[model samples]
Each structure stands twice: as C-alpha cells, then as structure tokens.
Target: MKALVLAGGSGTRLRPITHTSAKQLVPVANKPVLFYGLESIAAAGIREVGIVVGHSAEEIQSAVGAGDAFGLDTTYIRQEAPLGLAHAVLVSRDFLQDEDFVMYLGDNFIVGGITGLVDEFRRARPDAGILLTRVADPSAFGVAELGTTGRVCRLEEKPEQPRSDLALVGVYLFSPAVHRAVRAIKPSQRGELEITHALQWLIDEGYEVRSTVIDGYWKDTGNVSDMLEVNRTVLESLEPAVRGSVDTASQIIGRVRIEEGARVTGSRIVGPAIVGAGTVITHSYVGPYTSIAAGCRLLDSEIEYSIVLSGSAIQGVRRVEASLIGRNVDVTPAPAVPAAHRLVLGDHSKVQISA
Candidate 1:
C-alpha cells in the first residue's frame, strides 16, 4: 500500500499565521506538524507516498523535498485549488492508480501512529476503512453513525444535528474501489467535494466499509489552543537530553532538552520544556510545557505552556503563557510612555488586549 498526504487547504481558522505560512508547517515541539504524519507513514512501512499541495506548495515541497530524508520516495501532486479531501484524491488518481493507500491529513496528530491501522487494512483489504474517535463537538467534524453490528451505517459532513459523536479521524485506508466513489459524488453546499460524502456513496452502494474507533490521543491542530495543547502533550513524553551549554548560574530541572548550541545562563528551566538549537535563555524563568524554537532568544522573561517559533526574541517581558508566537517575532517590554495601544494585524486576525 502507498500513502497520500493532503497538505492543501487554506487554514482560514489559523488566520494571520496561515496567511503567511502553511498550517501544516506550524511547528510543535520545534518540528513541523506535517513531519509527524510523514514520519508515521514512513514508520508504517509504506514507502511510496504522494503529497497533495495547494497555495503553499512551494514551501511544503522545499521542506519535504523528494522525501528522501523520511525514507520514502514522494510525489508532489498539485491541487489547483483548496477544493477538499475528496478532490485531493481525485487529483492524485494518477499517482494512486490501482493501489490500496492510506490518506493522512498533514496537520493531524495521532499519538501512536497508524502502523497498526495500516497493517489491519492490508490484511482485511476492505474497500474502505476509516479511523473514528468520539469528539465533544461532532458538528465541527465529519461524523459517522454506526450500525448494530458495529459497522459504519452513515456518514455526514459537519451536520447541524449529528447522529453520533464518532467524528472521522484524519487518517483513512482505501482500496482502488474509491476511485469510482469519488467520481460518483457531487460537491456539498460548501462548494467542495467532502470525503465524508464519498464514503457515504460507497456505503449506499453496498461497498465494504469499516471503521476503527481509536481510544488514543488525536488532535487537529487547526487553531491556537489546539496547537498549544498538542505541544504540551508531545512535550510530556520528551526525552531529557542536554547537548548544549548550561552555565554555572543556570539551574535546569525536570525533563528538559537543551538542544545543541543552545545556551542557558542565570536561568531556571522546568521541563517538559525545550530550548531549541542555538537559542539563548538568560536571566529568565523558563517554565514547564514550553518550546522555544531554534535560533531564538529569551532574556529576563518568564514563559510557560507556550510555543515560540524560530528566530523570535522575548526580552524583558514579565511573563507569557499559553501563547503561540510566530517566526521572527520580537516580544519586548512596551514603552510605558506610550500608554495607548498600537497594532498591525492581517485579515481574520484576533488579538486580546489588556484594558
């Protein structure tokens, strides 16, 4: 079996960040979210992979390259627009022809990886297999209704009145039979061909469809809170390693990883946290569940439960928590003389200011 990874879609939910960068490239634990899914697919032992890309195609292609680094020969299939998941498969037909493949959403994070699910699908050879997880808000996701025999009875895309809370997880396994299903369905009200509808088409036509209700952790890192939460969860299992310099004035505690060339001076870092390569943390209290990306600087500031992306700087800040700072961002103490607020924001940007 091969793999098809969807890295398309304009992440409107992520707003200003997605305006400049692809949502799939958003870093968690200092690694791009898309990398996690790719690593999982490589770990599943399905080498031949095809990545579906849209507006951020150049960036994604640059980061992933030929996929040699991930031990897979990848093919980049360009989607003309941000159509939808089913549209992605339709465009990737040339690469996925006549082969059973797994479709993994690039920005989704699954704790254990999909090796087991791929193995099961390969053995059973079902016409279609989907991963499902119970979600609190089924209306936000493509939901599935199961029959008495524990089979998927119906599927709906973001239904107002969901029949069940079993939301479809990003990963899906499918036989070549899905090619016909995609061609048979029409676009939903959203003007895009949803994957859920294609699955419903298969079910209505009596094609064998199966589902696995995963009990493990899974996240669609689409928004800020979800990204921060996923970062915290991944940090919880971080293996402690110090390949960088920690000065005599600094004190490191708990499961912290000070990556190579990073320097910590006169600071205290309480882990499940990471100071990325070449980053400098000085005279600060780096709290738990935080990840400072490579080439960053934090001085006389206290931060916890946040993610600071590459080349950013935080200096003389009182404290920051549960935040997502983007690349090349500079955070410093605001001038007291200018009591008034100043702002430059993009479309759909959200900001919370202290009154």
Candidate 2:
C-alpha cells in the first residue's frame, strides 16, 4: 500500500492567514499540522507517498521537498482546482497505479497516529475502509450510517439532516476498486466530485466497506479555534527539559521543554509549554498550553494558551491568550491617543456616546 496526502484546499475559513499561507502549514506544537500527518504515514510503514497540492502547491512542495525529512519518497500530484476528495483520487491515479493506498488529509490532526488502522487494513485487505468518529455536528462532515454487520450502509456529505453522528474523520483506506467507483459517480450539485457519493456507489455495488469508530483525539485544523485547541492538546504531552539557559531570575514550572540555544531570564513559564530552539523569553509569563516556536522573542508581555510562531516578537504587550500569532509578527503596544468616538448614525437611530 502507498500513501496519498491531500494538502491542496484553499483555506478560506482561516484567512487572511490562509490568504498568505497554506492552512496545512499552520503549526500545532511548533510543527506544521501537515508534517504530523506525514510523520504518521511514515510510521505506518508504507512509503511511496503522493501529495495532492492545489492553490498553495508551491509552499507545500518547498516544505516537503524529496520527503527525506519524513523518510519517504514523495511525488507531487497537481490538482488544477479545489475539487473534492474523489477528484484528488482521480488525478492521482497514475501515482497510485492499482495499489491500495491510504488517503490522509494534511490539515487533520489525529493524536495517536494511524499505525493501528493501517495495520488492520493491511491484514483485512478490505475493498474500502473509513475511520469515523462521533461528532456533535455531523451536518458539517461526511457522515456514515453503519449496519448491524459493521458494514457501511449509507453515506452523505454535509447533509442538513444527518442519519447519524458518525462523521468521517478525514482518513481513509481504499483498495484499487475505488477507482471504478470514483469514475461511476457524477459530480454533485457543488460542481465537484464528492467522495461520499463515490463511497455510496461502492456500497451500491456490493463492495466491502468497513469502518472504525475512533475514540482517540482527532481534529480538523481548518479554523483558528481548532488550531489552538490542537496545539494545547499536543502541548499537554510535552516532555520537560531545559536544553538551553534558564537564568536565576526565571522560574520554570511543570512539563516544559526548553530547546537548545533558548534562554529564559526573569520570566515565569508555567508548563505544559515549550520554548523552541533559539527563542528567548524574558520578563514575561509563558503560561500553560503555549508553544513559542523557534527564533522567537517574548519580552515584557504575558502569553498563555497561545501559539507564537517562529521569528515573532511579543514585546510590551500586556497579555495574549488563546491566540494564534503567525510567523515573523511583532506584537507591541500602539501609540496612546485621546479617547473619542466618531459615528455615522442612521436616520432615526438611537445613539449614545461614552465620553
């Protein structure tokens, strides 16, 4: 079996961050969420991976060049547009070449990795397999209704009224028979080939479609809130170490990892947190569930429950929490000005000004 990772969606929900960067590249625990998926695929012992890239193909390619970092030989498959998941399978046919493969969504974070699922699929060799988890909002995902025999009975993508809460978890394993199913299904009203429709066709054709309900941590990091939550979850398991310097004036508490060349002075870091390599934390409060990425500088500020990417400097900012600060950003106080209000009120509008 091979691996096919999809990294090509235009993440409009995460703009203006997605406007400038790929959503897959967003860091969770100081590592790109995409990298975690790739690492998981590698750990599953199946190589010969193909990455389906679209709008941010260049960025994805640049970061995953040759795939040596993840110990796999990767081929970049270009998807011309933001077509659906089945379309990605259709375009990657040449690379897949009749081989059973695992399709992993690049932006999705599954805490325990896919090794167990991959092993099960390899042993069972099912016609198709899907990972499902019960979600609160099944209408927002591709949902499945399973039968008494543990077979997939029905599937729908983003239905207003869902049959069940068993939402697709963005990780799928398919045998080569899925190619015929993809070709048989027509594009949905959304003008793209829906993977759910293809899977439905497989069920209609009497193919074996298996599913596993995951009880572990999994998240689709498509929005800021989910991204921060995943960051916190990953940080909770961080190993405490101080490879760098923690001066006499600083207080390091809990499960913190201070990487090489990082320095902490006059600061109080309450972990489950990490200060990445080359980062400096001085006179600030680095609170729990926070990850300060490499080469960053945090001075005279207090940040907790947040992610500060590489080269970012948060100086003199009073406090930041539950935030996603992007790469190379500078967070400082704006110049003070007299308080005033300027309003353009509508006709017959009741307005009050605080002065």
Highest-scoring model, TM-score: 2
Off by over 4 Å in 2: 342-355
Q: What is the alpha-carbon RMSD of candidate 2 to the true structure?
A: 1.6
Model 2 CA lDDT for position 213: 97
Q: TM-scores of all models?
A: 0.95, 0.96
Residue 274's lDDT within candidate 2 is 89
Worst lDDT window (10 residues) for model 2? Answer: 346-355
Backbone clashes counted, model 2: 0
How many times do residue backbones clash in model 1?
A: 0
Q: Pairs clashing in candidate 2?
A: none
Relative to the true structure, candidate 1 has a C-alpha RMSD (angstroms) of: 5.3
Cα distance off (Å), candidate 2, residue 217: 0.8
